[model samples]
Target: MVADAMELATRALLEANLGLAEQVITGDERIDDARSACEEQAYALLALQAPVATDLRTVLAAIHAAESLERMGDLALHVAKAARRRHPAPVLPEPVNRYFAEMGRVAVQLARRAEEVIRSQDVAAARAIEDADDEMDDLHRHLFTLIMNKEWEHGVASAVDVTLLGRFYERYADHAVSVAKRVVFVVTGRMPGTVSDDDL
Candidate 1:
């Protein structure tokens, strides 16, 4: 169920990036519903089955993971709105568009990695997910530099729009990393050290 929820969130993000504004908003409801259901199931399992130690950790991690994925869905919607606001005019230049696409791809990969770690209980895969998130952060910083430098120079509104879009994409990837960290916590019971202190 957790895996399914993650997949749905990833799909919602992809749709948002593809310029389906209405669908992205509508899909957020489903993501919220799924998160609620997952929370209920986790609580029920704790109440009825009395999971202990590792089992308890698994349930708690699942709840956190669902929450993170839900936030990712919301961020994706925000990105869609920004995209819509800049409609008919390309906010991102070709190079920035390429970067945005790469960021989206990395976000999806992180989501899938989280799913795999959860389903397989593989701590190593979770670590790899964490490492991949570092790359996303680097790309995010690069995108920011491009926007701030007025690389596209579409004027103030377009620059702001692209900046916000880059921020949303970066945030989406961060949430995915959060899910991966939760997976690692579930398996190993330790929070990993930060790769860097940058907000992205």
Candidate 2:
């Protein structure tokens, strides 16, 4: 669900489509609902089954992943709102648009991989999510460079918009990596460092 929202929100932002933007914005509630439902289910299992060791790790991982997914949804929401605010006028300049488009693609990929990791619990595949996130981080840096370049013609407002939008995409990927890392920890009993919201 969050993956779909990210894809739609990216499209809406790129095309400056108000209808799509509105759809993403309004659909955020569904993601929130899913998060709530997931937590409820996880809690019920915990109480009823008295899960232990690997079983407990699996239950806890589900809870963490759900929260990360919800956060990814919120990031997508932020992107849609940015698009709506600049409707009839693009949020991104032409030079940086392609970068954002690529970021969006990578964001979607990471989200999909995270979903698969949860379902399959393939430790190797879960580790690869971090590599994909590194790609997203690289894209974020490229966009930031474009924004901060002295030759940048866009005004401060536009630069700020692009920066925040880039950050939103980067953060979304981070959450996906977080979800995957939790799954890896569940399987291998080793936790990786995750980027926090306050990191950037």
Candidate 2 lDDT over residue span 42-161, tens digit each? 999999999998999988988998899999999999999999998989988899889989999999999998999889999999889888888998888888778878999989999989
- TM for every model, in the order presented, reads 0.82, 0.96
Q: What is the C-alpha lDDT of each candidate?
A: 0.69, 0.90
List where candidate 2 sits over 4 angstroms from the true fold. 194-200
Superposed model 1: Cα runs more than 4 Å off: 1-19, 150-152, 191-200
Candidate 1, residue 24: the lDDT equals: 63
> What's model 1's TM-score?
0.82
lDDT of 1 by residue, 98-185 (tens): 7776777786677777777778878778778768988888988887787678455567775676677677667766777777777777
Clashing pairs in 2: none
Give lDDT for model 2.
0.90
Model 2 worst lDDT run, 10 consecutive residues: 191-200
